[model samples]
Target chain A: MVTVHSTSPHFKANARRALGDEQLQRALTNVPGGFIAKRQHAKDKLPEFDALRDEARDLKNHTLAHLDVYLEEYEARVIASGGHVHWCETPDEACRTVIDICKAHDARTVTKGKSMVTEEIHLNAAMQAAGIQPVETDLGEYIIQLRGETPSHIIAPAVHLNKDQIEADFRATHTHLPADRQLEEGAQLVNEARQILRQKYIDADVGITGANFLVAETGTSIIVTNEGNGDLTQSLPKAHIVMATIEKIVPTLEDASTILRLLGRNGTGQEFTSYTTFSTGPRRADDPDGPDEYHVVILDNGRTGMIGSDFQDMLRCIRCGACLNHCPVYQAVGGHAYGWVYPGPMGSVLTPSLIGVDQAGHLPNASTFCGRCEEVCPMRIPLPKMMRHWREREFERHLSPVTVRYGIGAWAFMAKRPKLYRLATGIAARLLKLWAGKTGRLEALAGAGGWTRHRDLPAPQGPTFMAQWKRRRP
Target chain B: MSAREAIFARLRHQLAAGSSEQDRRETASARIAGHAANLIPARAQIDHGAQVKLFIDQAEAVQATVKTLASHDDVPDEVTAYLRKHNLPQAIRHGTDAQLSGLDWHGRAPSLTVSHGPADPHDEASLSHAVAGVAETGTLILTSGPDNPTTLNFLPENHIVVVRAADITGTYEDVWQTIRATYGERQMPRTVNMITGPSRTGDIEQRIELGAHGPRRLHIIIIEN
Candidate 1:
């Protein structure tokens, strides 16, 4: 597990490094055109996309409001259906419970689907530490796992890695495989991975997957995937464990359907994913093949504190990765720059809070407050507001640098009175333009080195827009 | 503790904590109403035959074959003809409706088996139905039942869905409303799947390829009134 708390400083340094890396800049240049254009095209085809979003939002809000009741109801139903439900208050507890389950089964190998909660808990490392070989079965996740990196994007984990990099990783990993083999094409790479993962799917002792939505009424967990890996993971293994956040529970399948309509449209441009599996319990008495034991670990992990807070809206997130695609900072630096499991605007707000303000404080400040993330967010989490909240929390905890705090205080004192603010702005604008000259660009600044290193900031042409507007009104 | 006593004690504690049980109940009810208002739209009169035709057209557009049968008795023969048309040597997987228990399949094909259990990936084709078809997005909702196992819809190489004309709805909202009416507030079905088209991905170099994971072919049988 990549701990955001421990890696905040490293992430800030790397993001600064990323700002100077021309190769990373070139790689990210296509993201806005690629994901944004595709999503717009998809939205244009469906006029009811906004209406569907509204429905999904409402459904999620309603479910969360009654989460306690629904969770108990779901627990009863899962028990009745011959499945065990375990409540975990923290990531360590969730991992311990899963490890215990694995120990009980004497599991050696575990095949895993693409699960965000498992990522949150860093279950793979824990399982490996316990002497279990955890294999990622999803194609994209498998690629990232082979490369020894965390998932950058939620939907496309290795979206940052090009075909050449993938080929290099494969060549380095697959030693017995010929180096001169013609694996230039993506299809060939996919087929090669498919052949490799087939044996793991069949031979694994246990399987783990995340729940997209858990139906409270029926006690069933829904796992949607573009690949059929989730099905094989849940079915082939002798024991299956579903690690999910508590907020994933919806009241019924009807409610689940309402959310599903928005999930596909928001995440990818698909009406539905290729595979949407709903497993209630272990295989039935007469059923031919499925896991003999089924367990659902509902993880809280600081989510309970978020339920009634200002950040409660974050719980409505379905992990669609829409905001990540539209986020400018995310596109530039990629997921690794965020230095956590989640890597975009959502991550900036969520990672800091889940970890702590002092440890991951730089994450909240890594944004321009562009509002594009909030615009594209499916659950409509006010990301900028949440980021600002984190900023306030950072300040209160004295997590911000002393120079930045003093500079902000000095600016605030000046701005408190109108005459002083106008006088300061008038002199500053003239001085900046004098330095900028005819090009109307400032290549460097006295104090702001971070802003000038990557790109030139344009100087003000004349009086401030607010000052000009005030003069014209008078 | 007795159930009534436990309930009363919990209610009393909530009331003592500056919240009332009635207030919570009213808020929950209001939230549910608000959700229903946003999710369930005004009912629109549906032309079921036209909706089925729309799904059939979509299926064909995605390069899948379609066949319609008069009754359960005609399914085996139609399936056999389908296999023969495709030049397949052996009968692949066969799926039946929950209402198809009495249907005779003794003479039509030797390899045909009723799809009752979980689907094996080797099955070339599996048959099922759409409980309702959303013409807006050209999607099909398949709720899990005894005959329509969710695995059959995903695990096969080819999917053959049987849709009755009356089950087709115009939009997703309409479909949800219909589902709610059928299942009511209690005892809802385990799974309700909305399948739009064949599985596809543009992940590798942004090139669209069918059958990246699930069935590449999606066949539909729209039985007309």
Candidate 2:
């Protein structure tokens, strides 16, 4: 079961706490060599990857624009295929709908595929509270679930846990099994999980999975996974439930195909995942095997408010997880530090909107705006621009601290007037130079405790880049 | 209720507080058109042999096995030779393509117990063929046909896929167009499986595993000119 961390006063504190975590820090340090390197290799092979991304972005934009039409079409197709569609306005309604269905079906055990929407709604805990067992079948999710922790990464849910920690967790949890087993190896851990989950898949009364894309024309839910566990989860169960956000809808299978091409290449640098399964409906009478019933619960949960707004581009997200994989903040602190189901560039923009700005205002401010996220985004979401919009909203509502507001206001005032900006920058440089002494680095600063806590803050150079450029031109 | 009525009701409710109806309609229509245009390529064609060769090159580059067979009759012999060469056990569950039915599998490989189609997780090897091979991404599109079940491509240790010289396409768009033309607007096939190479993931410690959850080894047999 997934637990929602108490994020009200302690999110930043927890993130700072996480920064001190040696194990998490070691795991996160591998992101650059892992996702970034693989992506570069994949991109190097496909010179037309950027062109494909542009096309995919355009496609997503087009789909979001006509989302209503496509959603209706998709709903029609789903109904025609004998699947029930439930529209939910909030996370509570979505969770209630799922619970009601499970109750109606007399379901006790629900085997789940990895679903971000389920995470968003906090479904597993709710199900367990209702006296039902919702087992997360994805290896990573299962590991985290056993640990009673939420996912710390989008793609790899247990990214924060080292092999030793996992080994310990397994040993503690699987007391029936032999202790002192060689659980340090990755494959051995995978095999151990496979043995445990294989039984859950067969015995599951109900199966639930998230849709990567919902094709309105075909009324199909497209699930792309390297593991075929998703297919097993859906196929072997008596009932299958797809919990997807309303924004996941695309117009047709063809459109889904275009997005599929982008999904793997961006997420994990694969040409295609091992299993890109498309399930249209419950089992046909003639069909050898499949679920007897299927339900697709489309959760709105403040997304409609975002539509046609500056943040509307966020709905185009395919959940390829490129942003999380490449994000410096996420790479440093991991997902739990963000204190939400969604994390990284997309999460920073989204979590605040869904949960309310007051609760999650710090998310948007956690970025350096380095543009690497925007550079790697498959849908080409103007993430920094959206983040700035959130910042502006936060400021307008007086959510930002008074000191930050005054400092930013002063900076903005100086920036508007070039002369004042130059003078202010000159004075700041002089002050920094005086503070620096003969050496260029400052070990600590009086007001900048947050900046100095992690690493050294470099002292300002002789002049700004703008001033240097002007001097060179003149 | 009619799909149109349901859609309109939902739209009206969603846009009740904000945005004009005309604006919403225009935006919706434009978005639909754009998504459709992106999906439907103007020029989508099937380029057979060259595309197949490209797929083979990609599979080989990823450290997978690639071979060619002269005809369907050569399949059982080829299978036996491959198993023997790899030093695999003789008692293996054989998943055969529908085209292979023409060949006398019982007479050739008497000891082999053949499962006509599909494969269970316990199976050692699953053999099938490509419906269309896309050159752009080096992907093999394997739809659920009479001879091929989608499970065979996934639920096994080793996947041996057969690709005819005639069924290769240049791009994904080309493959989609073919699929549309083949299936029309009727009830489509239950599944359309696309396999690129061997199943892989680098999630744990950034180390790439050949088979994380699906087939560990992917062997391609291209029947060429």
Candidate 3:
């Protein structure tokens, strides 16, 4: 029932198209202007921020090391709290399980919060195919859903859109509203959406959400959102279905707090989101208002393969999108250029791991290896190192394009012999310098159009780094 | 094999260390039961009075309005003033939460009409009593029961919460400890809502606009005497 559609194989074309899109370029400015400085300010305010990151990393590492037992314990707790736990090995199976649950409840319309896991499994399409309406309650998600496009950013789903584009989309879809009504300001758009969705939340039969963390100690699923859509989505419906991956488990509330310290500060630069709701199970006997049935579907979807692979550390990702915020490669081309469910440095490593390097090889190659992603990662994931691992895999499998293979082959041939490497680099540096003709930039390179197409490639100012190192040391 | 078993098998197979299954179970249980605290922010390790001041400062920084009253008895006066100042409805929807219901709203402000139960669709404002307030993030912790229905937190256009100054703690860890003690070991209320500021979204061009879906205004009443 769930089909994963990917354009990763055409990542180059996607990146090129994204670069030429003027509206996207305008929208992308929000990345550095908004996220980077906010994260820095939040980090600077707390003296123990780095120490908490270390604790968060250690907690995830410990949890992953004994993942099986911890998951077993977590399931038992969920059952004890009067919640159903469904284990799924694939996205299709997870989708099928959800459809069955909805059918059991005779649900016609299901409201949803912002959940990356559901996006990963393409839950909306599957639900639509089954004749169920999946209403996105999050303002960002609702905008993109109206446009019939996938999320371009993880945390900010509609970040790639400008106000004009959004206003146009609203006018086109919300025909019932006054056609000429003012929707110029951000608050106006928000208020309009609130008025429209308020009735949908009350009419929804089932609500599906993604958990930020699942506590093994008490079987609670927690969601942190600046908007309280996730709370209303789950609280008003007859049944609450939680769609989550297996790796989202933590040991206790204390551990969740440790990670929370980093998640908001690093992700949105807030101390905490507006609502961090912890739901244990179905509504209790005396509860006046809440869902009667609670179900949690634990998905694997090839992540179990990552458990012991070189990419196992990727499981520690909390989907903060800070890497996307800090990644230069991601900033230049935007997330749509990455061509998948996830798009960033973390995606560069993870996309290939989930869907083979042969198909997603361009993702790893997209990085500048500035090491900013790893530096900013709250979980301390070595993203550049993992991307390098994928590059090696791509080369070994002979899946890389022939030109890239030969370029690396020739470079490796020289790199092995130190004298020849220095000689070859020295000659090329001088050739490039001579070709510059005092302009100090190259308009184009013969075989590497990708390097010089957007901006002039800066000419080497001096000899190769190795040659300068030897001269200075000697 | 069942999907659950297969998934678990693959995980254990991939992560097959030398430890026995029993050993891993022991480790997990010990960890869950221990409920150990990690490195808490030094900002949260202050005295109660400082914590209270920090709570107010932190809460206000996030755009939540905080007003401290001498006692819970003065809550009705402030609520009426707030509702009138904003020109909101002369009524509020609230739950049967004792701390809120026990207040003398009828006597103190006869002009203001207050009702109880889960939130009504057209309600302009709602009120609740927070179990605790975390000073570090200026977040209020509300447990869902008949006392404070979860819907009251998100269903209205404006939300008002009253927290006793004594209940405000310095860290989320302190709140967790209190939860464990009140709910009994490893048990919790059906829902525990931790609210910070009001509803907001940066989804539109990354410009944060308040009141995306929930309340636009979050007014906090801290009883200090």
Candidate 4:
């Protein structure tokens, strides 16, 4: 139900607007609440957590190395269990397949769980265009849906909104209720959404959800959720459709357990999510109540290209959002500035790969390279190095802005001649010091107004690093 | 080529990892058949008593209330007492699990009304017997069957689960092993739900709130006997 135009190409403008919007600035203050501390506590408690991460990474590696066979095996197992597998090479095929399933089922209203793949394919938009109404069941997802906004955070879809903003949205949408009802507390808001969505769950003809992991060994799609909405959404419907990327596969239940050990700890610092459901086929003949139809739509939207490329290591990501939480840039500007479904360090490398570099070249350059993301990544993805790779790609293709290209060209020319570089830097450093006579800081610097506009840049001290090093060593 | 064929072809082109397709299929099948458990945490490798203690501790850590009963007979009393203590409704819904149906609710807790079926939206409480409990994360493994409907785990305000002490395992690996032994390899029930605690969400300004579209309170009754 989220509406997104993906202003990713205008990331700088989005960030500028985000930084200035007082409401968004107020919301950004809440982005870093105890996530870092909570993850650290969990890591300290479990000594084998890192070891389990290594094992999980290796298992995913093994699966990807033989991805073709695993996909075939998974398909066979799903079919054997009385489910259908729809292979989709692009987002269009995936969306079409989902819409076809809904139309076949005569689904007027379909309930959905929080799924990034569905977001990737714009499934809700597709379904809406096909005259099928989609209802988001996750509380966070529902909030964002009511407001007609994309998910700011993967796990917490409504992370960008304050409670008051949500209250206003609820008042506007739930107009049938009394005009002066008290929706004051978080619990009250949750209960209100719960009461409203309960009927939608039962009324839904088909339920769609994203898989956290697709186990080939048992032909099961696993979903981990703190809220139990996914269970209700899938259980109460007549049909269940699982939309997932091909990379979310583990060879066995044991491999899934290894990944499970890291997902929760890195994501929300919980030892485990409240519910981890492994759904195989639809309701069996003897089953009292469950969906009658089960379908798994496997999507490959540019992931096939990342298989053997330099960005291949990114596929190991479990979508934990730890990188987002630890990213300084993400904390400063929040998710909307990245202008897409995914944001932060992982998005920096992944956005360009999914949508070409020319459209999202700014995402990679937005990082401070603090290396916090790679440190906290459960899969040990080298995010900063990959961002540098994207920067290199941008430069090679001349995708970077004219100013940036010229600046880099000037710097590279001086760097190739070390003596000239030292002389130029020495003179510039002294000139900067003279310019910053008494204050020891420049209010504005030429060619870098973006940096000095809001905060003062510290003027250069005495001399360049090379000059100081030469005098000290000699 | 169809999307399936194109995807396969693309994968083949990218990952022609110096082996024939037959060899890759063999490698994958072997791995799946082997089904290895990679690492078991030290916390989960403990004695039975320690494991039970740890399970209780971890479950309570996640805000799930727990109590050890002498037997199933005591469950009726415990369930009634919990309902009364919390000032909840005196009725509970459950599937046709033998452990629950066998409890002499008529004889012991006369006021507690019990019903059998999948949970309805109006049901205030639901009960099911867990197939296994993992001590590593204080998780209960509930496999869906005709008698143990999956809806009972959700759709209710309060969920009461009964897990026998003997079924408690040290890690999720043990639970999966038991499942494989019970269900046979590569076969499972419609759904296998591993529930750690009551439904919760931190979506509202990252503030923790329980009972988000699922049971608000999860009361576990362990059969110590």
- Best by the DockQ measure: 3
DockQ (model 4, Cα): 0.87
**Of models 2 and 3, which has the larger TM-score?**
3
TM-score to native of every candidate shown = 0.87, 0.90, 0.98, 0.98
TM of chain B vs. native, candidate 2: 0.76
Stretches of candidate 2 off by over 4 Å are A1-9, A412-425, A453-456, A461-474, B1-47, B83-97, B116-122, B145-147
Interface root-mean-square deviation, each candidate:
5.6, 4.0, 0.8, 0.9
DockQ of each: 0.25, 0.33, 0.90, 0.87
- Which runs in model 1 stand beyond 4 Å of their true positions? A1-6, A20-30, A174-181, B1-45, B57-89, B95-121, B129-136, B141-151, B170-185, B188-193, B202-207
Mind sharing the TM-score for model 2?
A: 0.90
Q: For model 4, what is the error of residue A286's alpha carbon versus the real structure, in angstroms, after optimal superposition? A: 1.3
lDDT (Cα atoms) of all candidates against the true structure: 0.73, 0.76, 0.91, 0.90
Query: lDDT by residue for model 2 over A71-150, one digit each (tens)?
Result: 77778778888999988776777788899988988988999999989988899988998998999977778888998988
Model 4: which docking level applies? high
Candidate 2 contains a number of clashing pairs equal to 1
Candidate 4, residues B1-225, lDDT tens digits: the string is 999999899999888965678889999999999988888889989999999989999999999999998898888888899999889999998888888898899989999999889988889988899998999999999999867999999998999999999999899989888988998999989999999989999888888999999999999999987
